[model samples]
Structure formats: structure tokens, C-alpha cells
Target: MRTLRRSTRGRIGRIDSRDAKTGIGAAELPALAGGRIERVSVAREQDSVASRFAERIREEEELRLSPLAARSYPAVRVRPEEDCALRTPFQRDRDRIVHCKAFRRLTHKTQVFVAPRGDHYRTRLTHTLEVTTISRTVARALALNEDLVEAIGLGHDLGHPPFGHIGEEVLDSCLKERFGEDFRHYEQSLRIVDELERDGMGLNLTEPVRDGIVRHSSRAPLPETLEGRIVRVIDRVAYINHDIDDAVRAGLLREEELPREPIEVLGSSGSARIDSLVHDMVEHSATAGDIVQGPRAGPAMAALRDFMFEHVYLGPAVRAEHAKISSVIRRLFEHYVEHPEQLPRDLAGGDGTAAEDVASRVTDYLAGMTDRYCIRRYTELQVPQAFAR
Candidate 1:
């Protein structure tokens, strides 16, 4: 139990928790004894176990005064708190998501294509995978917390409605009218993971992850650390390029129609374009004086984003379908509100129905939809399905 002085992570020494910094949960959360540790890994680890795990003291002298360098919040109180064999924060997050019902439901959620489409057409599951990879890589490169970024990536879309953004917008509108409160997917994702996941067990994810999920909208959070910023940027990069590909497949827009800037600066295809954009953002952010460049990239990227918004997002083909989908969800909300018996066994006799019946039913039903199910429900309500499930 000799104290070692080193420049690496996971080192044992007398460090104030207020000034404590360890690598995000690649190894394990530093024990909360507030004194010393045996073997810990910095979120930044080198190759050697003894050196990487070799104790480094983060005494107050080495600590940075900035908010970005602050220690992570204490881990959530999950089960099996043996004190000795505790899970790493990342492992806990992984387990929490696996056990949650919402994570399971992602299999049927839309990424762009509907259910039962070609297996490769990015279900919400595949989309999460892509985001996770992109987020992790960026975090690692930035020397940011990979565990927090990974957790955020996994939990980002947890609140997406049954048919993806289409379903989310429909539900938001339907619920807003009933309750006079908007139901954003970002907020809903947080609410679902916080209030509805695991029979209301909630994911109880870390603060950093929750912030990413809550602020994964057009208005990105002023991140406390680089990891969060990476997640936010990678998210936009992943969605825009993937959406373009999806639109191309759906014949909503041709690849040739993409704006010249993003195409020329990035590339013309899906993967290439994503890589290019990610690199540009990362490189720009990593450079001295340009590290964040957050507000700076706005003008150039905003114009391209607007072009996509005009040419691809609101294009006749997609909105035409949105109208049909919206009508379907709206009708279902009306039906289930009047007749609560049709709702699942779990939702009856709750405060949700008592206060806002229509919004509650819409939330309940929409939360369970597969891509095809949303479509089928729409058909059933409007045209009467010949073979109803």
C-alpha cells in the first residue's frame, strides 16, 4: 500500500474528490472511499497495465480549475452493490439499457426504412450502432470520456416514437393539442428513459449521457466536456448523411441533388460523407483557437442543413406519406381515448389517463408501434385492414 507518484491514470494517492479525475469507466469507477485507490484507469490509458493501471495521484496541484475537467458524478445505485465487485460505469449503463424494455423495442423502431424491409436497411438498432461508433471514436480522439459518450449514443433515440421521427412529430402534435404541452422526442427520450423505461424503473443513466439525450436537438447543450460535444456533432453528422441515403432509396431525392458544399467538402456518398463531415468538425474543433468553433460552423453548415430541409425533408414524397401517417396516429389517439380497454394491460387507471386521456393513449399506443404496425394501424383506422393484427 505504498503511494506512487506518476503521470498516468488509476493511480493511488491522497486526492480530493472535488479535484479527482479518472478515465471514464473503461476500467471501473474509482471507489468512493475519498482516500486512496488500489488500481484505477484514467479515461486516457496507455498500453502497459502496470503503468496505465499503475497508480497516479490526482492531488489538488495537478487538477484543472475549469468545469470541463471536473470529476464525473457518482455512479447510480444499481443492484448487487457488493462494494468490491462493483460494475464499471459503462458496464452498468450497458446492463441498464439491456434490461430496459425501451431498448428492446428499438428492434422494431424505424431508422428510415419500415419494418420487414431488407435486413440491412438500418432499423433504429442499426442507427444506434452507427451513432455509438461515431461518438466513441470522436470522444477517444478528443481525449474525452468514452463511456459517457457511448452511454449517450445508446440512449439518444430511446424516446423516438414507433415510426421514428415521423411518429414522434405525430405524437408531439397529437399530445400538444390535448395537454397544451409539446412532447419533443429529445424530451420524451429523457422522460422515457427516466420515467417509463423498465416498467418505470428508468435507465437512471449518468448526468453526461442524460444531458446529451436531453439536448440532442437543434439547440445542442453547452457541454461540460469534450465527450458531449462529440456526441452532439456526430449525431448531426450521422443523421444527415444517413437520411440522405434513406431518401435516395425511397426516391424522395436523388443523390445528384445534394448541395455542392457538403458534397464537395465532404463527399457524395453516405459513409464517405459522414467521415468527411466528422473529420472536418473534429479537426476544426481540435485545432488551437478553433477547438470548439461551435458558433462558427453554424453559417456554412446551416445553409446546407436548410437546403436538405427544403429539398429532401419537406419534399412532396415524404410529406405526402407524413400526412397519411399523421392522420393514422391522430385517429388512433381519438379511438383509444374514448375506449381505454384497447390500451395495454399496464396503462389503465393511471394519472396519465385521468388528466390527459387522449395524450396518454397516444403515448401508450405510439410507444409500442413497429414501423409496419404504425402503417397498419393507419390503414385500419382509415381504410379497414383486411387482415388486422
Candidate 2:
């Protein structure tokens, strides 16, 4: 018979070796031994800590949240199976958005500039972070649900196609021409979380988070929750200021060239502008009991947005690049529609649906691609490369 021995590793009751001839089961050895076996309660301790922290957070929300703030205790969409012991619904939503493949793709997607030569230019992911920062600042000031606001901000642009709005426009045009369907990024964002993510399993996000994501664009209706509303406002605030900074960096616009009235009212620089806008938003929204900008600051920000559209967004240099990007997107879209089999297996439509369904799937797959990925795919399909010997 082999002598039984215990190893003094981090875990307790770990059998060091098996005695095959002894006919003793490893698990039964502890019970069989006259000696007492001690079990480490690590999992129990961790669960206790997590449960206590979660309870404390709930208590904090009940005590500290404003009357207008969204509460996490009773989420609108309850998925008992998906509920977390450690995180609130909104917190879970934020984590899901952060960990998602779409969010990861944002790192290489266009924000304002498409594949800018300089590394300092912001990508879609950086822009999302900035928006979340600005939204949380406002939400915290209002004593609102910062978690909900953050989730919305982080996910607002998840469906934006490569090459920024230009790519969106090209895809929309192709879809319209082929299937008479429109491709709106905000709508696509909702689709991403609801259906396209996690191998078609979706994120199972909360109602408020989904509402905020779909309505983050100014063109959409206002969100029901004040937390969502905060993100809706801050999304514009982040992009306008950051786009200005990028435009300046790209030598597309100078500080002096920016519209004087809006600059004077908002601020002279990007950081100053964001600070001013955030302060104005907090002050006005607090007073009105709704998320809004001050009388003066609102118009100034609008003017700034208009200025960007005319200069940085639709300017000659950007328009030139937009033409090239539009061509790539349009060609790829058309090629895929013509040869549906070329699409990845998932997008090739095994559902026995109409051609329109295949077209929609193609649009979803293409829209999710990053800027560099789209360019590379286009080059691979369209450009003739020499075959290696």
C-alpha cells in the first residue's frame, strides 16, 4: 500500500498522489482518514463580499440618487437568468458594451478623420470614451444614474460604419437603391445590441440602456430616462469639441479660422469649450429638472456644429477623401449583393428568406467592419494582385 500524503499548496485537502492498489477514492480519502480535512472557504468569502458590496450600492442609490435620476434596483427589463450578484443592471450593461466585439472594433473605426496620418487623431473608440466621460460628469452633477449614462455613451456609436458618416451614407444609398431600405447608424446600433452581437444571441441589455443608445442621436426622439437624456446631450458636446481639435491638428482649420461668435460664447480652445458646455448644461438642467443647455451656450454649440459641417466635415480636403471611401463602400456592397455566396457563412442567408433579407445581413456585416478592414477587404476583392510563384 502506498502511503497517503497531503501537499501544502494554496488549496487545502489536495491529495498529492493516487495509490491505485489501495482501492481508495481521492475524494473519499478525506472522509476515510481519521485526520480532519480543512476546506478553504474562498468562494463563499468572495460571494459574501460581492453580495455585501452590491447591497451597499443599492442602499447608496436609494439614499443618494436625485428624484429625477434613474434607479437600478428594479430594472425595466428583468432577465432573471442574466442578473448579476455583484453588479446592477446598468453596470452590467456598461460592462457588456465594454467587452463586446463591436466596442473593440471601434478602436480602428473612423471618428472625424478617416485613417489620419497622425497618431494623435481620435478613433471612434476614443470618441466614445470622451463622450462617456462628459456624460458621467453631467450625470454625477445631476445626481442621476451615472452607470446608465455611461452605458449609453459607450454604445451610442457602435453601429457607425467605417469612414465615418461617409461610409454610412454610401451604405444607406446602396441599400436604398437595391432594396429600398434605409441604413441609419442609430437604428443599426439598436439592432447590434438587440440581435447581431454574440453570435445572434444579443447583449440582453436593459431597456433604458437600449433606449438611450437608439436615441443618442439628435435626430431621434428624447430618451425616457434623464440618464439617457444626459448622454444624448453630451454625445454632441464631445464630438463637436473633439472634432474641432482634430480639424486644427489636421491643418484643416486654424483656431483663428473658427467662427468667432460660437468660439467666444463656448470657449477659445477644445478643453475650455467642453468645460464651458458641461458647466452650462449642469446649471441649466439642474434648474429646469431636465437635461438641456443654457440659452447662450445652446446656440453657440449649434453654431459650432454648423461650422464643423461646413469646414471639417464637408470641406474640400475631407470631401476628396469621402469620394474615395464612398467608392470603396459602394463597390463592396454591390459586389456582395451580386455574389451573395462571397459573404461569410453567417451572412450568406441560410434562413430561406428573400433577397432583401440577404441584403440586410450583408449591410450589417459590412457596416460593422473597421475602417482599415473595409479598405483591406476592398483591395483584396477589387485590386488585382500578382499570384506568388
Candidate 3:
């Protein structure tokens, strides 16, 4: 067997004298035996880079964070099996979320418009990215744990169903009617990382990350961390602006038709509105020692949100399509409830004794579907096609 030697200056001395004749001196030879000089140099450079990155994380924790910032040291949930020398706990959470299957599914899920044909319309994935960008800006300004805020923002909508809020509403009503339970995307998002991801092995995320994902929705309870609170407010800031942009693009609403009072306070354009909200949040939150918006900007933002709900979200322009999608969701749920065996083995009850388990399994499977997949499956099951068509 060949002996393995680590790269070192001393090892270069072992090069053959013939190497000297080739204008390769001992000092110029590769330090690692049986490896190219470039390989050894690259390996050393990678090691140095990794070391500097780890050191930078530590220094950032010490020098950059404020007293109110959540520290990555002493993580709330320690997983000895998944510890990383190069990344802090929150950073690891962010990485895991970005790599998960659920996160990928967000690309195909509806954001506002159902199965919108326009390439520019925001999907669930784009919406999550916007939330993350806005949240990080606020987090960094406050000297908070941006990694934690990013993980939460990236994961906040991981459990959203295929047809936007209409899909969610259908699922909620179906669950309540069939099983005396409710379906909330926030709770489902928590369920995903904790139990459903990684083929049931789960992401095993830290407590703060999990808390932020479950509490990012305004309807949910406020999260315990400042990072979580930052994401919570930023979620509103992101969706309100982007949904308006999407509505205008869809020809459902005109930019000029937007309510004037809120526009005067927030800003005329989407970018200006986002800038105003973020700046106001940072200024107010820094002064208050907590995440908040200025007195003026807060109410103005709320009015903008209310305007979107009335004119775009619940508008007549999309009502017919929304009802059709809601009907599809209802029909799909009923079919699964009647035929649990059609579900994947992991989701279908093996013994079929517990109705609740069957309902839950069906719900899990349905919630994870993408918009196209849901529609395709609905067509296959509900619509009968003529032979050889």
C-alpha cells in the first residue's frame, strides 16, 4: 500500500533529483506526495478560507450584535449529531431550509393568482425570497441575528397549499367539516420541519428557527425572539407591496385606482412603499428597543393591506376563478377522504382503524402538492376523457 502524507514544506524535499533537471526544485515541488502542486495549494487555500469564515462568525457574534440580538452561542436546541464547525446554529437552519424539498415546492405553489400564466407574477418561492430580503434588511439594521430571521422568512410559507389562500380556505373548511379540526399554513409549516420533511426524519431545526416559521403569520402568536418579530412584520411589508404589484400587472387594479390616503403616507410606487416601510420600521424599532413601525407608517401600511384585501384579494375580477379552484380543492379532499389507499404508502393508513390518522395523512399529502400537480391529479380523477382522444 502507498503511504499517505499530508501537505507540508518539509515533504517537498523528498522530490527526485531529476525534478531539478526539469527546472522543478525541491522548494518548488508539491508538498503533498502523489498530488499536483496546484491541488495542494488549492486544499490549503480552502482550509484557510473555511478557518477565516468560522472566525468571522465568532467575531460577528462578539462585535456586531447588540445586547438585544439573539446570539448563536448556546443554541436553544442542540443536535450533537448535526453540529457544524463552519456554521452557527441559525446559519445551519437557513442552509437546511434552503435545501429542503418543501422549500423547492414553493416555486410551483400559488402566491396570489392561481396558476398565473405570466412569468413575472410572484409565486410562493418569490414571495418567500422577498420576505427574506426585507426581513434581513430590518434584522441587520437592528443588529439582530439575521441568519435566524432569514431561516424563518425562508420557511414562513413552506406549507402554503397550491391555489393560494383559496386552497387554504378550502382545506380549512374541509378539515373542520370532516374531522372537527382546522388547517392553518403556519401550523403546517411547523409540522413540516418537525415531522414531514426528509421523508419523516425532519430537519430538526433549532427552537428559534422553528418559532419564527410558526409565528411569521400575523394571525399567529408573536414569536419569542426579536428575529422572529422582525420576520413577522416584514412578511406583511413584503406581501402587501408585491400583491399590489401583481394585481396591477393582472389588470385587476390600476396603480392610480389605489386608495389615495394610504398612498400619500406609504408612497406612490411599490419600491418607494417598501423603502418607506423598511426605513420606518428600522427607525422605530431601534428607538423602541423592539421591532415596530413608526406611528404614521404603521397605520398607513395597514390601510394599504386593507385596500388590497377589498379591491384585489376579494375583488369580483377573480371571484369566478377562485370559486372554481376552491371547488377543485373541496372535491380533491373528499375523494382522498373516501379513498385513502390512493395516497402514498407513507400517507395512507396501513390498518385503516383511525379515521383521524387517515384524514391527517390525506391532508399532509394534499398540502404538499404543487399547483400543476394538484390540477393534473384533479383532472385525472374527476374528469372522464373519451378513449383515444
Candidate 4:
């Protein structure tokens, strides 16, 4: 087949069939010399097919989706670029979040258990996938943007520190003590996408995706879009249910010990509870024109969340490791703060930058570690040379 003279993106300039056979390599030819070339066209047939798929998605979204749903096309980004021939903007954002380094690090990060003996215990990555899946289900049912919801869900927890919430607490404490600034994982998540990932170039994610990620935590403000709101609520849904399963598996809690009222209202099993919550969300959100839970499921899920906090999250079994985890985090924080040079060059602010900036960078460095990596770093710092190696 003949090749057309085109740019890197496969956009061909005006050229004739005879010129197409020449296969312009490094050789520079006359620019449509004397207008011998005809009008421009696609060099590859697949490009047109891929563009049609993207266009079709936009058209379907417009026709089928609810008016409240966030549209995938015409997505807003901090840096504008050409749309993908094969993907909607939200789909591209999802792919970017899925493929980034922060996403990969989540696999080794903690969800609930610091280091469980059982392999089936959920890691941060698993928790993220669960949240994304559940959010997508809710989005689809409500005629909200599934791709947008999915992007938000997948990227929401990308900034969680090692060792789960405990890591977050310790980091927060460290920051408040030294810099008088709070360290919330949700904010850090925004920071990750806005300034940390891509070596400070950021993910360049859409505004909706970024907004959803930073607001997924209940402590933060609600997200702007209904799709973002779905992820925010479903984040709790995913964690509260899955964490219970993990707690039971770890022998930290028993099935019978669960609060009887909430258990009966939601369900006996994890799957049942999730199903109930998803249904409630879809039903209420469809009517409310916003993501919300039904009266029974909302209070019931809240009750279960409260129960987990009291019995499992802040309970003795999990708290037993708090001291050790705190020590590791504090020592690491101190080490990095004292030796800001140890942080990545980008994080380690240049000379004349405020001391608080250095401390903040140290927090970023520590917050990005995995459980085993954090422990290893602590051991390497504290242990004797003969024993450390």
C-alpha cells in the first residue's frame, strides 16, 4: 500500500498518489510545489474508525444520559490539547490515572491491615478498584457519567500514605507540630495529580476528576459534579464494607458482634450490604438529581461506619501497632526534615525557600512510601550497620 506524506499524528498534507509512493523519510521536498498535490486526507483508515467511536460515545451520552450527568466531551483541562481519536476526555483521564506511577504504588500500600498474613486481604489498589467498580454501577444506573465517576474513583486515594489511615494520622501530626499546617490525604491527592506526578508536570487531569479526587473524603467539601459525588459517597461505602471483611479475617471483629440494627437494615454479608447501599444510592440519586442514599440505607450505613470506627478502627487490636507505626513515621519525618537534601531534588526546595517548604517536601517524600519501604527505611536509619545490611 502507498504511504502518504503526513505529520507524526498521521495527519496528511495535500499530496498525490505518485508522491505517496515516495515514502518521505528524512528527505525534505518542495511544499506542494506548484499545487501538484490534491486535498489532504487520512493516511490510515483506522483513524477515521477510531474517531467515529469517540464521536458516537459523545452522541449517545447526549441522547441517553440524564441532563444532570457530566459530559465526557469538551472536558476542561489545565493544559488544553487535541482530543484523542479513540477516547473521550474522561476515558483518557481514566487511562492516565490507571497507568501512572502513583497508581502502581497503591498495590503495595496498605488498605486496612498493615501487613496481613493472608494474601486475600485488600490492599490500597484493591480498595480503589472496588470503589471504582461500585461508583461506576451507581453512575450507570443514575444515567450519570460512568467514565467520569470511574476516573474520580480510581484516582481518589492515590495520595494515601503507607500503612493506611494510621500513616495519615502520623503524617498529619508531624506536619502540624513542625509547620502548623494540616496534612489531609485528599488534598495531597490533588497535589499528586496537580504537581507531584509526572515529575511535577502533573497528570493534567480534567477539572472534574481533580475536584472529585480532592473531595472524596467526607471531611472535605462535596464534589462539584454528581459523578464526583458518587465517588465521594461510594468511597465510604467501599471502605466501610471491605474493612469489616478485613477486620473479621484478622480476628479483630466477629460477625455476631456487629451492631444488630445496622446489620439487619443493611445485610448480614458484605456483598449484601454493598448491593443494598448501591441500590439505595441509585434510587435516591435518580429522584434527587444528586448522589444520595436512601433514609434506611444512609442511616444504616452510617451506623455500620460508626461501629467500625469504635470496634475495629480505633479498637485495641488495630491500635496495638499504633505506637510502632507512629515511631517509624515520626523518626522518618524528623530525618527527612533535618536532612532535606535526602528528599528528591524537586521536592527539596532550593536555597532561600522557607523552612516550612522543606518540611512540606519531607512530608511528601514520606507520604509516598509503601509499608515495607517505610519500614526498611526506618530500619536502615535506626539499626546498626552490621545488623542493618
lDDT of 4 by residue, 70-112 (tens): 8887878999988887788999999999999889999999998
* Candidate 2: count of backbone clashes, pairs at least 3 residues apart or interchain: 0
For model 3, what is the alpha-carbon lDDT of residue 158?
Answer: 90
Please tell me which predicted candidate would have the highest TM-score against the true structure: 4
lDDT of the structure predicted as candidate 2: 0.84
- Candidate 4 local accuracy as lDDT? 0.86
**TM-score for all models, in order of appearance:** 0.73, 0.87, 0.86, 0.88
lDDT for 272 in candidate 3 is: 97
Candidate 3, residues 20-94, lDDT tens digits: the string is 335543333354445644333555644655556555676768898988988786566634454575688888889
Residues 1-389 of candidate 2 have per-residue lDDT tens digits of: 33332322212244434546656545342334546665444465556666665567777888899988888877666344545877888898999989999999999999878778998999999999999998898889889998998899999999999989888888989899989999999999988998888887788899999999999888899999998888888888888999989889999988999999998898898999999999999998887988888889999999999989998888898898977988899889988787777677664245434787778778888999999889888888876766311
Scored by CA lDDT, what does every candidate get?
Answer: 0.63, 0.84, 0.83, 0.86
> Lowest lDDT 10-mer window, candidate 2?
3-12
Cα error, residue 199 of model 4, in Å, equals: 1.3
Q: RMSD for each model, in Å, please? A: 10.3, 7.5, 5.7, 6.0
- Candidate 3's C-alpha runs over 4 A off are 1-56, 78-82, 348-353, 385-389
Decoy 4 TM-score against native: 0.88
Worst 10 residues of 3 by lDDT: 1-10
Give me the runs in candidate 2 sitting further than 4 Å from their true place. 1-42, 50-54, 78-82, 348-353, 387-389
* Candidate number of the best lDDT: 4
**For model 1, how does the per-residue alpha-carbon lDDT over 25-142 read when each residue is reduced to its tens digit?**
3244554345666456553344442343212212331342223432333443433232112344555675677567777788888775444235556688778878889887766565
Clashing residue pairs in candidate 4 are none
